[model samples]
Target: METVVGIEDTEDGKFEDSGVDRSSSALSSPKQISNPIVYKLVRVEGDGRLVPATDDEVMEVGDFLECENSEMHVVADTGQSLECISIERSSSGNLQLECSEGTAEADMGKLNAKLQYIEQILQKVKEEEKQRISCGSPVHSHLNVDSQCSADKFPAMDGKVQSENQEIPSIASSLNYTHSSGSIDQCSRPSEGVIESGSSASAVYSNLKPDLSMSDGEICLDKLSIRELHELFKVTFGRETTVKDKQWLKRRIAMSLTNSCDVSATTFIIKDNKIVRKFEEDSSGNLNAASLISLENMTEEEDGNFKDSSPVKDCGSDDNRVVSETRLGNCSIGYELEDENHQTEQRAAKRIRKPTKRYIEELSENESREHNPRLLISNKSTGHGHVSPTSYVRPAARNVFSEVRIYVTRSDYLGGSDVQIPCVSRVRRSRPRKDNTSLMKFHPTGMSETATKLSNKLLEHCSDAGSEIPDNVLKSRMPAKFHQPASSEPAKEKQCPTTGTAELRQELRPKRADSCSHTSDDDIVTVPTAKGGMRRKHHRAWTLIEVMKLVEGVSRCGAGRWSEIKRLSFSSYSYRTSVDLKDKWRNLLKASSALTPSPADDGMNSRKHGTAPIPEKILLRVRELAEMNSQVPPSYSSSNLAAGAGSVHGRDRSGYL
Candidate 1:
């Protein structure tokens, strides 16, 4: 780099004849330049290295003399330049010149040497990273070390790590300037001293700037554009990326450069209109511990001894704890690898729940049906029992499952006592109505066989014991009066010994045992068989007493209140419903209107067919109630007779009144 300075040609170099004396005198005593021309100062050291000058270092025309072994001189483009000006002490304790029409070139060799030094440091960093990776150090540990190293080396940058490419030139330029509060002082150029002393440039370059301040070590990579970051990324990682996200690019570049798992801190991120700072995570304490361990390992590796590398002997007293920590680190690494693999391949699969019992049963049933339908059918038919092959008659398919009784024959117990031992059936769930109907339809033959077997057993027992049948059962077995024996009586009589077992069973078996005869004797009604699949409700006839109570109830409660009548009067007659009372009342009303009373008969009247007769007064009371309620058939002529009867009754009641 070169700097331009403007100067006035004072007296047109008038002291040329005595130039040597005048130049020596002007060099000894300097004067400030008083020209209206603008000048840019480039600081040239006594050793000949060039750097930019600050405002305070630029001398005015009348500054005082200050020099020690270093003299202020002017080197203008025109060889015969004007007078020398002011002099001042540079902060580095060297003399600086403020002069007219001066130009100088920056020392490229020194800058190149500085750049090489930066590259060497970067190379050392890469080598250390490779060594850490080779020694089985985790990426997170490397990141933590990088963070700490960065914080220590560039304490002023606030985690803002820039690429070496951007940092090297700045570092080289900053090398010439020493940090100071007032002004940047120029340091002595090493090449100038070595060259003046007749030393080789190699010797000068070998001993680089020892005075370079760590305070000037900041590199601002956050200001880099996406294209620059991409280039940096390629240079650092030897790869290419299509991602345009600035944060991701910066993070990738930083990680590649540092060989770490973490990015630089959020404070260093560039905030612009397009890019904004998001949430920041705090530095983990684990990272710090890992970093310390990593640093210790590196020191151990460098020293080539592992025994003395422990930093906290008292803390990690147990070797097992160290082993456990290593195990935990390995586990974390494994988990990270697994997560990466999962992400790279596809998302993790959802966990499945165990099948429910119903589902398993359904699945099993379906499998059985698909593979062996007959096995499923047999299992259901036998109700999970083993059916004997000899008696396993394949029953018709039923909608439900039920257990069947399979009696063991007498032959099986022939060697034992003659007393029969009943086979106990397994308890099962009650079949639904539909299942019951289906069972009846499916196994009618089985039922018939059961009935025959039971009858045979009873007959054998009765004959063997010579027990007489009950008189009532014998009476029931006797033929009805109208049931005539057919002409084939001899055939029936011939077959009497072998009559069907069902008929024999019915004839022999009484409904109740002798001990329960008392209950059986009380109004034993045999339900007449109906043709319908469902039996009809038995019709119970209303008695004279019930009719009298109903009439009394009607008189007290008025008519059409059968529910009230039934609740108050016929409460004990559970079989006599309110509907039955309503029906009986209707019949009584019709009978009252139809039956003409003979004047001789005033008491209870009986029908020709004998049944307990309802009293005439009760019938008359029912008619009176019906007439009073108007819900009955109107007996127009009977009303007149009723009035005459009422008057006659009134006349009879008059004497009592």
Candidate 2:
């Protein structure tokens, strides 16, 4: 070979060129193999091929060159090249660079830029570290394994964390961090500094590893200042966190306490659990801070289990033991306390005293009989020709005038037929004078007046004798003035002597006889026949006017014969032939008054004078009688008879008929 290069010399090579600067490879001699610095090739320019840059060639990592007519770049360091690494263009026009044991160094400018980028990254990391320290971490380097942070160290943290550890002693007296154990340990650090224990950090880190037991564990990463804790929670519980998880834990603990103890005790414990540490003393009676924290952690973890273990208990009194029966529709025994004994006595006194069989049968028979149809006649046997006492037969009148006598009974009378005794007096009838002139000198007008007076006197006697005129009879009488003919104009007179006097006497006398005969028949027509013959056959038929007149006269004087008339008869010859003429007249008058016009207007007035238009006097009398009858009690037999006879027969006859 031309000049063999010594491997030993190259192993510990040096640049010693004097004309060329040894400080940089660019200034070195091309043929001298001086110090060869290695670099990684990071980038290349377009269409560049990497060929071996000779010792004389100054090459950079991104330099383009031609090798064997192919484009390449300085892609690897000398060491990489020694290790058979190369960068070449593939058939698809892409560069393929590879190294076995060493990477190609970049160009000096690129390496310097990368180193500046790394310096900036280091600066950012220092800034983040400073921010983390200012805010507080869950763990710090200064805390002892068993010792916890001061109670006031973490002023913003919940008391639940502080209450987890109570055994830590004061160290950094000014630090305000609260240890998981609830003890108030003062430390020498500043009040604002947090001192997290190493054990807590380790525990937090260990908890972050995926564990199947904690798969369902929920974590809350809230406004807590503990960054590591937040991280651990995110890692352990899959990062979808909320405040609800912490609330759920608190609720479970509260529910457990409520169920396990009385309300007073449970509320006390729950409120205390938030601020004070609950501890279990060790065998040596020493409270370990770590043990306290562990207990609190265990409590928090087992809160759900504790709630499941305990159940609510009944706290009612003995009176509540009996189940109450609900009453239907508000129905209840409303008995008072005072009635309790009465009710009990009543219940005890109650005996099932069933009715006797015969009594029950009798009741059933009575009910059946009430439902059955009644028989109109009774069944009983009797001897031949023996009349049944049940048969009702009206007893016959015991005397000829018994019925009439009963009819005439007065208000004071009891049952008796008292025949009125007649006091006989004799009056001689004046014999018809043979010499008519002397005896007839008595004035006919005076005789007529005397007869009228006698008639009125007789009527008074008849009315006094208890023969009261019926209301129908009185109502049927005509008006008093109806029959009095109106006065006619006076006749002309002529002067004459004895012959004229005699002629006048004949004329007046004949006229008087005719008038007397006509009036006699007219008055007798109203009277009944003695033989019960037709009244019209034996008597003159009465005109309506005559009937009215008769009715008025009877109403005025009460019912009687002509001798008993109160006023002189306008027609003088009438006579009543019936033995009980007054009674028969009363009946006839009543029947005539009772007759009403037929519906077909039979030429008669429909209105009965007294019956339709009852006189005010009669109505007043009726009301008075009713009032008097009402005053009499029904229990008195005399009063009953009086009332019955008076009401049923006298004034009440119109209604009955």
Candidate 3:
């Protein structure tokens, strides 16, 4: 047949254009259609055509359904839309949908009632706070409340029923008040029917809801989170809460409720001021009066206990839970031998126990030593900026010291313990400049032997704890000193060689023979070599006696004639070159300028200098020296006279005979 054919490239890349009818093959292959639902189909392609669709008519989700001449289109309804088919085949055949036809606001009276109730509760709580403030008791007033109620049968808020006031004994211990201890008791009890402990606890226990429910069911108090419970405590007693100690918080809340008489709960008894135990008195109210008179502590089953030193008399009623107890010995810090009668009285008391461990001793058993933070006893006040009887035991400074010590003592570069924390990646940079630049503008160019010796001693101890400087670096920083004797004959001096750091650091290495012959009098003379040569210097120091001799020679020979002075007095100083003599005299003049008192301070310095009595012989010599210069007879101030004969001697130097 000469008919059109569809061409498609096969997987092998061959174009197959066969002239054949694929419709016949598909029809003969059995149409894979499952049970299909019937729909009334209307064709809108040509003229108006409406036809009932066969049961097998193809349909699927997203196929557009449009009413003729309408702009809207909805997805084809594929799921069972017929009520008869769904009812016949499904298990939820009888399901009837109930739609809410009215708005929730239509029931205003019920909502308003709930709002009013919540407002009233908040008002009551606020009023209680105000009263506490007036009475000098904060909401966070007392560490523990003292509720005057019968045992277990806590009065409910509605006053209609009673519930058991209960908690595990472990919780009592965790109410540790880890920070401080205080009792500003003036805590008012909740009104009758204010607390529904059993129902509230159950509700909170079951669902742990915080928000108030608007359902028809009665609203119950929610289980407080650690923070919420802490806030409750802080507002009630002004006690700080430890967020980390969740165990302590839950117990504290329970204890607070137990102590409140207003909550109509059972009273909690304190043991040795450490443990909080429950206290149950008789309901007849007779025991309340007797309790005031009696010094004996109360006793109960499984919960409350207090120490009683009072003699036990049989009440004859089985209701009295007190049992005569015997103790083998005492574990108190300062226990004394008991008197015969006193011991007998203790023996007769209705206190019974198996002689168990103390509270602290028991606590030690459950906790491991490794996991605990060191707690040193702190006797000082907490100093929390409160004018209250609060003395909290804070975490001591020892813990901080321990942590810092651990960090400092780390052996590796990474400073890692169990977990690895890499050391900071420092950038590669040149070494820091450590050579100290002199601060003074006019530092001495040279020092006498005494000054040099003193400076050496001081420099030896100049080690900074922050960064230790190497010995070679320190030695390199010291200026070269000259100690030469002037002489008529000139002698060649050995010069120091310019050495690298490795050679200069010979002092740091093992003791070795010095290769350089640079002797004691060799000064670090900077001689200009040809050009572009490193400067070389020799090590030497000037002595005080040599300096004094140079001064005397300068005074005798006059300052300008350096070679003559060097030959006359410094003859034995073979190392004293003419230039060295001149340099020495110039420094002496500079030093004399510092020693000479300022002109303005002359009169004041005279009286001040009077205390330093100079020898009469020195004054006579000064007068003798002055006689030779009678041409311009010098007038000397007391300050100049007190400065010594050097100032006087130098005074006539300009026209010395």
Best by lDDT: 1
- What is the clash count of model 1? 4
Alpha-carbon runs more than 4 Å astray in model 2: 1-537, 560-562, 574-590, 597-657
Higher TM-score: candidate 2 or 3?
Answer: 3
Candidate 3 global lDDT: 0.19
**Which run of 10 residues does model 1 get worst, by summed lDDT?**
178-187
Query: What is the C-alpha lDDT profile of model 1 across 1-657, one tens digit per residue?
Result: 000010011110111101211222221111121221112233333333323345444332112111110122111101001100100011111011111001112223222222122222222232332343345454443323222222221221111111110222111101111111001000011111101111111122122212222211012235567776676555433357777887677555444332211100000010000011111110111122222222222223322211232211111111111111111121112113222332222112111112111111111111101111111111111111112122211111110001111111111011111111111111111110011111221122332112111111111211111101111122233132101111111111111112211222222111111121122122233445564333223233355556766766665565567877766665433334577788888888876655446524533344543434555665666566666657433344345434543543444234222
RMSD (Å) per prediction: 50.2, 66.8, 41.4
For each candidate, what TM-score against the reference? 0.18, 0.12, 0.16
Best by TM-score: 1
The 0-to-1 C-alpha lDDT of every candidate, in the order given, reads 0.24, 0.19, 0.19
Candidate 1 local lDDT, residue 288: 20
Lowest summed lDDT across 10 adjacent residues in model 2 is found at 322-331
Better of 1 and 3 by TM-score: 1
Question: For each candidate, how many residue pairs have backbone atoms clashing (under 3 Å)?
Answer: 4, 35, 19
lDDT of 3 at 303: 18
Arrange candidates by lDDT, highest first: which order?
1, 3, 2
Candidate 3 residues lying further than 4 Å off, grouped into runs, are 1-530, 598-657
Ranking by TM-score, best first?
1, 3, 2
Which of the predicted structures, 1 or 3, would earn the higher lDDT when compared with the native?
Answer: 1
